[model samples]
Target: MFKVCGYTCNRNDFLKKHMRLHSGERHYKCEVCGYACNQKCDFKRHMRTHSGERRYMCKICGKEFTGSDQLMKHLRIHTEERPYTCKVCGKSFYQSAHLKQHIKMHSGERPYMCEVCGKAFKRSGILKTHMRIHTGERPYECDVCGKAFKRSGILKTHMRIHTGERQYKCDVCGKTFISSCYLKTHMRIHTGDIPYKCDVCGKAFISSGDLKAHIRIHTGERPYKCDVCGKAFTQNSTLKAHTRIHTRESPFTCEVCGCACKQRGTLKKLMRLHTRERLYKCEVCGYALNQSGDLIDDMKTHSEEGLFMCGVYGKTFKQSGNLKKHMRTHTRERPYMCGVCGKAFPKSCNLKTHMRIHTGERPYKCEVCGFACNQSGSLKKHMVLHKGERPFKCEVCGYACYQSDELTDHMRSHAKEKLCEVCGKEFKLKGNLKTHMRIHTGEKPYKCDVCGYKCNQNGTMKIHMRLHTGERPYKCEVCGEAFKQSGNLTEHTKTHTEERPYMCEVCGHAFRQSCNLKTHMRIHTGERPYNCEVCSKAFAESQTLKAHMRIHTGDGPNKSEVRGYACKQSSDIQGRNRTNVTFAMKHSNMIPGSNT
Candidate 1:
């Protein structure tokens, strides 16, 4: 007898053939497939796959295989026999190869390791599948969609999507699934068996994948990152959903309103808006919500226990995420930033809400009035008008309001005033009085570093900085025109409609803007706020004051010709004025048909 590399052989020639496994020698090669093997018998089996030859057949299921051992394994399904059983877990399998793989899992022995990523696997076949991630080799292609996959088993499962073949059925719910593993996970809903649990958070999950994703919260590990925004997420699916913000891809569509969403879960929630089906319910308060996350948030209101505490202000929140957001308020951390507008926000939802102004997406709508709005909070406020519900009221004056914040603001009228010493201006809040003082002191602290533009308010500085950056984030949906400020977008939207709310009482003239009406009123009052410093001449408009100053500087119209300069040909001035007009029309949408 002869032995080589743990394989015993009866002859020396057989032992020499077995030695080729470790020696990295492949003598037998198939001409058609280029499949090389150490043994001639294994090489012959590889040829049978391309030849479409099945020599052995199973009588019970009418299935065929190229080898007798494969036929024998198929027969075990009809016999309902699992001869190979694991001693550790009592798990059984039909084939000895499967049992060997299962045993290695119990021993935590992963001998097969990928050379590229260093990922260990219990079986060599699994390691080969993992190698495709680095190699970019996808051999299995779908016939219908042409979508490629790395493994044959995954391709087989994907074929079920086209065929609609769901063989695995749950006995309890009668729900069907594509695979037995999915069915097993579904059965846990009925069994209430959450076997997988996070050791760090003590949160239980139905599957190991859910537990693995939950563990990332404690580890602060975000393996998946966005290529465009550099935003990291714990799950790959979450990163995929986030990438839609840059891509603007809305694959999932609603049937009723033709509304589109980037994710299927978002489409499902949008469908609930039309259906009005409250699927998630609170056990304590009997409050129902269409979204499960909203239900989870509502459930927190029922309990005061396990509240997260803020270190700075000592404020308590029901969720750790809310507590983390509260800490950012104290730290003045604005992590979520808009790539388009170059604006930073403390919360991601604030950034998302800000993005809708640029996107012109009015996702929320009033079902009663057919009115649509961008923000969900705006929709909720609009719904209050239709519902006519004044739940919040002042206790002292009986001043009722739709929102609690409005009632709180009304309560300030009853409180003592915060007086400004310089101007004798009485404000309801101390912060308002502080802002009022800046006007009297001529103090403009918020300044743009780019243009040295000064403003008393930080928000005005942010808007002014956009002028230097040439960023017009707000966009009109109808004309596809962009604007630097949201107030400019609001004024531009009025051009799309003939709804002029501002009117002159003296002249009976209507205007779309209150600022225009206020300027028109100055003509009737003969009030000239803009006064020329050179001649003490007054004008109703600031542009008139600027034109009057040009006369004193000898730069007025026809003044250069009077000074014997021949007006300087002014092609450069005309070109610069044209360029300025073009830029202003592009960013501020001053011209109506410029976008078209």
Candidate 2:
């Protein structure tokens, strides 16, 4: 029952000296190695190299260590005991340090900071790697590839190529990889498992990398920047390819096609197209694809039915890309801007077609309908409507579709074998299951064709592609309001209808969708997921988070209310409506009376 102050005052100040040991404030130095350490134990460990001391030994493995902590970590291999446990998920770790790192998974605490880039990391090891940017120190080099890395571990892994070492082998497929982590990821293909999932969208991924990319959809963290255009990327590979544009370095030269690609993977895929090699074939549908990604996109035609619906006509699409394009008819997210007329569009393909108006290029022509289009795909879809030919039919359900891709998508709803092991979510197609598994594992496969924009879904990539090509197809029927897609038209129609379906339970406020409602609910609930790294201030949304971050940079408050208050004059009438005298009087009287 002794007070902390009473006990601290009575102590002989030994604790202060002990704290200096933990802080690593050097009072001692080794003349031989020029190593200075604060603690006696650290000095003792450093002296081991000079003395050649092998006092701490393991009887089982005959391994020697200079420190007690190293010996304790090594003993875990023999005992196989994981004492440290995470409170959030009940995950166990062999080391206390590992357990502490695992705790950050719940708390999201990033303690380590890099002075060069001002990037924060949860682990000190990551921060050390980040410091290399400022120092320009790449210690690890691959002898085979002549590639350099900042870390020694990465160099060791790269050396595996020269050694032809396949140290890690998949137990299920017998596939070999240089690293255990890669093998662990490959194992998920056989198991059909995805452990990681997005809490916002319910999308699953097979790996943490995929999850990180998906999180960018919510946070919009484009870390990798391009020197040429000041454009940013989420992945390193994307940034590498983008740098090639400035350098004009196309290392990947095709032997057959003679086409040069910045990325080796893209070149490899292009080589397959030249060879006419349909390596990946669907077992259920007998559909063949040259690339695995194309096969995945093809499979989505079947599995993603009733999920991605058109906001315009309540029609569901198998692919989110189609649905997103369809949403342009409603939201009027005409991001693609033309340099000519200052007009914008939603889809790049549509923008390309629009460009034809200026250029007078009609590439696609209909034989029966006598309508010509800039794109063949549009003409094909248009021809189906004219001919009434529903050739593509589902074998299981006998549902006929005009397009073969649409039929393939419909057939997936009938399939029952594919299932994600992590979330237990069922999918009709294996490719969809693979993509869905990415939601759990957090693997992002789709990349932007223009800007190397990597995303979990092709829809996001398509939206990103619009930044390069200006395309707006959907035009308002009443006011000649041009839009990018049909969905924008529908959403624009809502402006006329004034129909708000989404309503907040707490405040009874109506909104267009559940997302808007949820965002509004945060106002009352005071729940903010987005936070500023500089000041550690929480924000309800990413926009708010960005505005809050600006404050740390000596920027003014970005909130509309705060800006309005700052701009307001003392004599000006302030209320809901300035013109409505009675309404202004009512609101003005209530403002001082209410706590808000």
Candidate 3:
């Protein structure tokens, strides 16, 4: 019914040739070479290579191409047109194939599969490189080092070393890198961009790999297992290093120290320790540390303000991990069990050292003291005590201490020095101030069970409990003297040491303990909190008030400091006089506060 025109007939022939190009059915042949093409358009483009013809030209950039399709794609860049859009995520792309790849992000689809390993990838190019694992084919080779790579892109990056090319540059730090991806990661420091976040802990990371590792902490999933020892690791690299332990491999050797390590990273870390290099530092305390993890742990100490409470004794510790371990003492739960003896401990290191005790093995030895210990940490602590090292210091009083416990005890002096502005009464301790305030409120919270004896302080009830139980837990290690309370033991320890750690601010006089220091501070403040309820007499100390109460109770005479003093007998006096007579005669020419 219709007649075909000459132009329509020629267009039908051109469409038939384009369909053959898509099918890859090459039929046309070249005369000079053995090159074959499916369509006349490809053969015409190939002839332009010998003729040096550049027909297609870009109007925006004035760039020329031999093909029309290449010119059309290049023009789209200047037009800024993206016709392709992903239906799954509503993401638009300039190309249809790019939109298809974007849909895979939502679908989690990995269509490309490798026949050799049964592994899959979202992209075909990734699967192609993965195939090299079975074939051992490295097609791309570097001219400089002659190192072959499965992917041509890796070889191209390797060639940068021989060419001395640094293409990626950071605008903030002015740092140059060979790869753009590495430069983009380094830029996160200046930008503070943490795109990756953990779903469980709400912790953000700069990189996705860090987020992946952090997620394992919440999931407790360790997929990487060592085949030789059947040990599991959360990270694959850690498992690889653990495998080397079974193989007894020492591949990484330090050039300077001549020390060999199983892992390369361990060798690098040891080199930094030997060099005394502190790359990471704490901003709060100016504490320099060799590793970033050490800096993080140190920051936790400052944030907790050195207040760590033990769950078992209702006592506080300076370290959190110490309190965590001490909690096991109350629950009697030991998670780290010995494999051979079936004995368990709160900490893994404790269990390890305990095993050595049964084996009669002392691995850690003191170089100077010649003392052997089961653990290196125990040896280090012993050495510190031997050296008389006082590293910890109190910030309030500028007092240096040998241990954290001593610093905590020193800070109690500051708490005792707090005075009431209205009453001008100083408290011996914060707890004492709180209890004395309850007296103004008529609040007697602590009631005894035996005689309904009521007191304002819980500490008074604890002291009263000794009457019922007849228990005295405090004992002196120096003189074998027993006490009903810890305060008495602390006071007795001073008699053996003759060491006074607490000192007065106004006067140069020192005291044996913080309680004595608190009593001395009342002289400067002119405040007395303790009162005699019977006669309305006020005293600086509760002991002085107790002595005043004796006057009201008609109990006995209040003894002074020198009331118990007695002169020695004639035989002892004569012996002391004979020794004094001999020493006085010898040191008569010596001046006071001077060597004779």
Hey, what RMSD does candidate 1 come out at? 11.9
Candidate of highest lDDT: 1
lDDT digits (tens) for residues 279-371 of candidate 1:
666777888788755865676677775567788777788778889888887899999999997999999999989998889889898889999
Q: Kindly list the per-residue Cα lDDT of model 2 for residues 1-596, writing each as its tens digit.
A: 12433324345555555556556678779999688977677888989978999788998999999988888888988999889988889998889999998888789899998876778999999898889888988977777678999988888888887798998987654658998888887676546477999998877778999888889878888998988799999887889998997898999899985667899889978987788877666655889877655655666666753357765688876667778888877887998887775678897866777888778778577777689888778897888888888888777778888887787777767665787799888877787777787777778889765667687877766666666777666777778887666666877877778889888887788987667788898899889888778777888888767655655675543223312332122233244224455444555655576434
Q: Please tell me which model should have the higher lDDT, number 1 or number 2.
A: 1
TM-score of 3: 0.41
TM accuracy, model 1: 0.57
lDDT of 3 by residue, 115-202 (tens): 8778989999888889897899999898878989998888887898679899998885466777887788767755658799877756
User: What's each prediction's TM-score?
Assistant: 0.57, 0.41, 0.41
Worst 10 residues of 3 by lDDT: 559-568
Instruction: Sort every candidate by lDDT, greatest first.
Output: 1, 3, 2
How does candidate 2 score on lDDT? 0.76
Worst 10 residues of 1 by lDDT: 559-568
What is the lDDT of every predicted structure here?
0.84, 0.76, 0.77
**RMSD from true fold, candidate 3:** 20.3
For model 3 the local lDDT of residue 11 reads: 70
